[model samples]
Target: MFNDEPGDNETFLYKLERESEVQKLIAHLKRSKKTYVRRRAATMLGNIAEISDPNERRQAVKALVSAIKTDEDDSVRAAAIDALYQRGEDAFDYLVAEIAEMGGSEATERTATTLLTEWLSADHLEFRMVAATALGERGATAAVPDLVRALTDPAPRVRTRAAQACGRLSDPRVVPPLSERLSDGRQQVREAAANALGAIGTDRALAELVPVTQADEEGLRLIAVDELGQFGSVKPVVVLVDALDDDSTTVQRAAMLSLLELLTTASTEELELICGTVVDELARADIQATVPALLDIAADGTRRRYRQTAIWLLSRITGDRYRSEVIDCLLPAIDKPDEETAQLAEAVLPELRSPELEKRLRVYLSRERGSEEARSRAQAVLDEICDGSSGELVTTGVDYTYVDSPADYTNQHSSRD
Candidate 1:
């Protein structure tokens, strides 16, 4: 009984029938010398303290409350606090009531407040981290203000958890304080802030995220790119498209991914304009995620540039579904009797599954008769459309078309629509 046999007490707790073993585990916890044994016993006691039946659980919770406040060891105390949550709202409500009652009784009453204070202020990082995490999980919105202040805590980890806790509250008011942390000196803290803002995900949050795209550091920029993608608005499309040219692959890829997300709703014209920036990369076929997105924009040809962009976008698509479109665009361009589009089409045709290039060389003799510059470009595009594949491919850097990058690859750009 003293040993608590790893699962014995827990087994009883799971069944909600450990009145005897619960007492034994509690006593052993008070006497155990090894920290691990005491901690384990404390956890079991906490678990046992929970009864599925409300009336019974009230009594069980009282004993656990006593354990949390009076445990000789810090670990035991922390474990008790954790287990308290499992007892459902009864345990916590009881705990809060106890704290209020203690305030009225003895001024020296070491209540739940006392325990909470100690855990948050303790020198041990894990204790504070766990306490913050548990509070966040509980999602006590009442604690949002306190969590906000903790954002400035000297320990980055604590502050990180605080941001996380605020995020869990999912309250808009937390946006300001949380946004402040985006420029946090610690990368870890910045990442935490990014996650929080992304999770909260309000327009206010997205607006705050916009400037971070140009943050001096690439890591922060990537974080901004990643977080922005969460909202999938074209508002950041220009921001992300600009990033496509970033010197760092990490930043570029992040931007690409963001754009891909935005493309789900972005207009074809918006996508067309975006083509030039992304098509070349698509053609490289290296970043498989951005391939479909480039193709989607390419297919929307309000402007020849978009088609041009599509042609370039086509070079990147190599999937089995992509074979036909790539072949059709290049095939017509080959003999469109125009050199440039013909050359461009030929460059990407191997991307298709037609007879060898030699076999299809003369296939487009009709369309190639005129408009060398025009026909060549048109035929090249036709080839891509003919060989287009269909699949939902992964992409990045998605933003709204009308809001950002209003350069208008087509004759006119529409910001309102």
Candidate 2:
């Protein structure tokens, strides 16, 4: 029934001084019959909160809180809530108090849960998002149905918050819907849904997540593979192993990491089973793509066992196929402060003995730029390879025979060597 030009209020509000403007916007926010006018006034009040005047800021905040309590239109109320949020942490307390007051002993006497549930159906997107988040935080089981419906909200953030809230609730009923969101167009939304499914952690939730690793979208497959690790069950090991061959390098890396996570908690039988599957998969995988990921895991200082596994995988996968690349990857590990890691790198170097590897090692030793300890390690490796003691290589659980001429070794020593 009310009509006004959109720019009319904005122009008039801009002409007023700061103090008068705050008061004028408050009047428009409280009395404007036009929905857009009230919405704009509420938005302007929030903007005014940034001013240096504490009294003016207080008045603007009070007006916004009043508008939220009395506004008939959901859009107006949503604008007020968003504006309060923009005012920063201090204004946020008022917003919380307003929500809490809804259930206070007044004529309406609406319970806080009932009001939040009702707001989930509000016309504005912010209202639905805040309502969904609050319901989940409160553990309002009765609001689960509404929160589930919110998972399909038109706004991606609303859907994301709803998904997160559903996760906090950890209700099995929300699992199917959360699973559906794993295919949501937005990456954040898809990730939220995957997280929610993981939080539920039911057998059914696990079942839903396992198949998503094979989803056509690499993003979905990545999320599923990552989430599968949190289950701490060996059931996803084979799927994760198979994922090592995924066409996407990122997904393949995620699969490898998930396998490592599973290894941390697997029983002896499970550990052997997983290790065997991984070894078999590595044999079939295009492991060249995984070199970077393996190098990172090996370099990580947090987990010794995983680091050992990474080094072993590198040896088995690269073999002699990627001589130069393997040398580059392992060289830095040679002087690592960790004795076991340094030893592991030194041990694997001989297994990779080839004319090309020896040449690269000699070049590394010749460089004046490398660390002294690393240079020393390289010198020893060069010595072992040239000494022909590398003839019976055994560290990597793999064997190779190298019969390079003594002449090849004689002049290969660098100035430092």
Candidate 3:
């Protein structure tokens, strides 16, 4: 089927399939324009492996078999297994053929390790990674030693891929090596470790990772928290809640967001406790990552209600002085432009305003990049300053006292809402 837009052979094959022209598609797929196109065509054919035309099926299968050996993309070629899933006895032949073609050193060892070792010596990083992944996925535990060795590959991508492939096999023996990698200097490597540990999912893996939540570096701890959240349960929740008291606001915020995500599955009481620290759980959990505010909260946040609860808890745990500091600490939120900060006064039951702290009087009327939200906030503060003292123009701090009864901060603070 000729089309207006010229594309690689895969696009033509897809077009032909839509037209229910399977027989002709199979023939053209064999002599593709390029190796990449040939592989994609094979993948689509595998998707429709049950095509009624026997001759067409044979031709598609032939193309797939050729791809298994010749095509460069191991991932696309790997689809053969899925294609053979229901084919039963016939599929068995394809599987055995792949294994035989890959495994050259007969009686002593299986898999493509011998060939792969030879390939690796020649700096074929892509093939080495692909072979390691395929071997591991194929349940060739014998490849674990080779896969682990790939962790030291000069190419970080290869090492990263190898770490992940090792996780897929989930062999106990790889745990020690993977554990050692828990503190890999590379960010990707460290993240990959958390992934491998998650895959391992052993009691040891859980124990090792729980402590990672408290790691001093924000990045590592974030990854650890993220991985732990994957194992979602009240225990991880409790651990995260405890982290809310950590010195780093970043850790506290991750704990809150993860805690919020946990709310999707947590009991109402737990969420209510979280509300005590951050009144804006939903705001903090925004996945759009649209603006810096979202990213800022996603990093480390002091959700107003959550902060209040933390203060209350601190007062109970430590004392009144720390509680005052917690309240004072809220200055950061009050001066910011966010819904979470806006509703905090009512939620926390404490009415405090930044009178001398430049008040952002203007509201963002609309939520867009160029909106006057920031300017409006600035104007509100400036207007208040001007109204309080007309004779002299003051530019420093804006007067933030309630227009009516400043003491009743909740009603005053909530007037806009």
Per-prediction TM-score to the true structure, in the order listed: 0.47, 0.66, 0.38
**Number of the predicted model whose TM-score against the real structure is largest:** 2
Candidate 3, 272-315: lDDT as tens digits: 65444433322233222212222344224555434433322322
Q: Find the candidate with the highest lDDT and give its number.
A: 2
Tens digit of per-residue lDDT, candidate 2, span 103-220: 5454344378888888888878778867877777667788899999998899997898899889989988898898889879888898788878877877678778898888887877
In candidate 1, what residue range of length 10 has the lowest lDDT sum? 391-400
- Model 1 scores a TM of 0.47
Model 2: worst 10 consecutive residues (lDDT sum)? 394-403
Model 3 misplaced regions, further than 4 Å: 1-122, 215-219, 229-239, 245-417
lDDT of each: 0.59, 0.76, 0.52
lDDT value, residue 318 of candidate 1: 58
| lDDT-better candidate, 1 vs 3 | 1
